[model samples]
Structures are given as structure tokens and as C-alpha cells.
Target: MTQLKAGDPAPNFSAKDEQGNTISLGDYKGKKLVVFFYPKASTPGCTVEACNLNDNFERFQSLGYEILGVSADSAKRQSNFKTKYGFQYPLLADEDKAVIEAFGVWGPKKFMGKEYDGIHRTTFVIDEKGVIENVITKVKTKDHTAQILAD
Candidate 1:
């Protein structure tokens, strides 16, 4: 798949949320979206990043942006993570990795000298028209909300 860049139209997809509700990119038409892809749900870095976003969720909403986090974890795992972190936004389960691959966030990763295929930590700022406004490839989990807000 081609690497997605700013101005590229985001791939529309319908995925299952933690609560088993269906969520589609088209459902947010005419609204800005922050679509974030993380390696795993409830991991240290992922948890911090999720909580940071949760803390600033109202701010994003105030700016007319809806936040959605995706991972290859199962729905149960996503639900547990959301409940544990008090996440106000939806967390989509992408066990099939279709959305992840479509966004070009699923690929080989290296950590501690071991390489494996997985979801890369990335985020996309999609505009109301479904065009990608910005691609945040280097995400710092601890302060992700402030970083995105600053951008």
C-alpha cells in the first residue's frame, strides 16, 4: 500500500467498537477526525497515550474534532482498556488489520533489536471532507494530546 500523506483521501471503513457498535468513517462526515493507530491496547505507552487523549477529549470536541483509536486488539481487550482508562471516545477493534493496512500503519516494527510485523504508532488528522490534513508519524505517547493540539 502507498504511504498515506496529507491531502490523500482517508479510506472509509466500518469497524466494530468496543461495545460492538458499528463505527464508520462516513458516519463522521462534515466533521474533523483524529484517527490514531497504536500498537496495542492497555500497554504502557498505549495507556498513557489513551489517557492523555481522554484528558483532552473535551478540548478536541470543542474544536469540532472527534477522536478514534484503532488497534489489532480484540473487542474485549479494547473494552477493558477503555473502561480502565475512562476513555470517553470510541476505541475500534481492528483484529483483521484491514483499516490498519489501508492507512499504512500496519508494518514491520523493531524494538530492542527484534523486528516483527505490527501496528506502527501513528495518527492522522482528517478534515471534514475526508482528506487527510496532517500525518503525525512520530508520536510521543506521554504528551500526545498537547502535541496534536499544538499542531
Candidate 2:
């Protein structure tokens, strides 16, 4: 994986959200953004991470950060996950993998001794100027909000 780092320009992307509404990096211009990618929607680890963020949504917002989740799932699936968890943020249905590849979070991953190509669970913190402020690779799903706000 070509991990993005602080000081690097976040790769811009346009994709459809769970609601089938178009969303783009440009829409969040001049705002802090948290774009997180999960391997799949509604999975165990993904659920913990998303719920943690949702539970602390106001904290992030008060700090001027907008949260967005991304995964290579269909719009319906993304919508289901969001509605089920009552997440206040939008979940990007990056079915085309455009946003995933743009961020270079797609690569080989091993689970239970099975190796396959998939989206790596990652989070990117983008500053108001559209530059990356932090990249969380070793994510603690149950405590992701703390990790993002740690800086």
C-alpha cells in the first residue's frame, strides 16, 4: 500500500454516497475531513469503528471535522449499514474503487491464513487546506475517535 502521510495532498475523488447522492472531495473544501475506509460494510471490525465515530460525532464536528466512510459496497448495503447504526455521516459507496485506489488503500491482506486483495482499514485526516494531517493505519476500532482526536 502506498500509504498517504502528513503534508501530502489528499487525492481528490467523486463518488456516490449511500443515499445515491453524489459526493466529492471538493464539497469539503476549506473544512477538516475524516475519510475512513473499511474492508466491508457492517462487518464486525467495521461496525465498531463506525459506531465509535458516530457516538463521538459531535466531538468531531465541534472540532470542525466532517466524517465520511468509504467501502467497495453497493449503495443499498451502505445505506443499510448507516441506517442500522444510525450513523449521522455519509458512507461513500465506492463500488468502482476509484476513491479507494486514489487513496492507495487497496492491496493484499491476509486473514485467517487466507490472502486476498481487499481494502485495508484506514483513515485519513485532511486539513482545511486539502492536505493530509494524519493517516491511521494501526486503527483501534473500539477507540477510533480517540485516535483521530489524539493530534
Candidate 3:
């Protein structure tokens, strides 16, 4: 995977959110952003990571950070996951993997001795100017917010 790093310019992207509303990176201009890419919606690790961020939504907002979740799932799936968990932030339905590829999180992964190409669970912290400030590859699902904050 061509992992993005601090000091890199975040790729510009536009995609439909879980609600089927158009969302673009431009929408968050001049604001600190946290773009997290999860493998699949409603899955075990994904759920914990998303819920942890949701539970600490206000904390991020208070710190001037806008959070966004991304995945290569269909809009319906994304919507269902968000509704079921009552996530406050928008989850992008990157069905085409456009956003996923732009962030360079699509690559090989291993699970239980099986290897396959998939979306890697990654998070990017972008500054107000759209430059990456941090990239978290080893994520702690239950304590993701803490990790981001600690960065």
C-alpha cells in the first residue's frame, strides 16, 4: 500500500454519503478533518472503531476536528450501519473505491491465513489546509479517539 504520511497533500475526493447526499473534500476546507477508512460497515472491528468515534464526537468537534468515515460499501449498507449505530458523522459510500484508492488504503490484507485485496483500516488526520498531519495504521478500535487525540 502507498501509505500516506504527514506532510502529504490529502487527495481531493467526492462521493455520496450514507444518506445519498453528495459529499466532497472541498466541503471541509479550512477545517481540521479526520478521514477514517474501514474495511466494511457493521463488521466487528469496524463497529467498535466507528462507535468509539461517535461516542467521542463532541470531543473532536470541540477540538476543531470534523470526522468522516469511508468504505467501499453500497449506500444502503452504509446507511443501515449509521442508522443502527446512530453515528453523528457522515459515512461516505465509496462503492467504486474511488475515495479508497485516492487515500491509498486499498491493498493486500491477510485474515486467518487468507490473503486478498481489500480496504485497510486506516485513519488520516488532515490540517486546515488539506495537508495530512498524521496517519494511524495500527488502530486501536476501542480507543481510536484517544489515539487521534494523543497525536
State which candidate has the highest lDDT: 2
lDDT values, one for every candidate: 0.91, 0.95, 0.94
RMSD each, Å? 1.2, 0.6, 0.7
* Candidate 2 residue lDDT tens string, 61-115: 9999999999999999999999999999999999999999999999999999999
Indicate which candidate wins on TM-score.
2
Prediction 3 TM-score vs. true: 0.98
Q: Estimate, for each residue in 1-151, the C-alpha lDDT of model 3 and write its tens digit.
A: 6567899999999999989899988999999999999999999999999999999999999999999999999999999999999999999999999999999999989999999999989999999999999999989999999999996
Error of 2 at 125 (Å): 0.2
Worst 10 residues of 1 by lDDT: 1-10
Write model 1 residue lDDT over 24-69, tens digit each, in one string: 9999999999999999998899999999899999999999999999
- Least well predicted 10-residue stretch by lDDT in candidate 2: 1-10
User: Candidate 1 has which clashing residue pairs, if any?
Assistant: none
Q: Which regions of candidate 2 deviate over 4 angstroms? A: none
Q: How close is candidate 1 to the true structure, as a TM-score?
A: 0.96
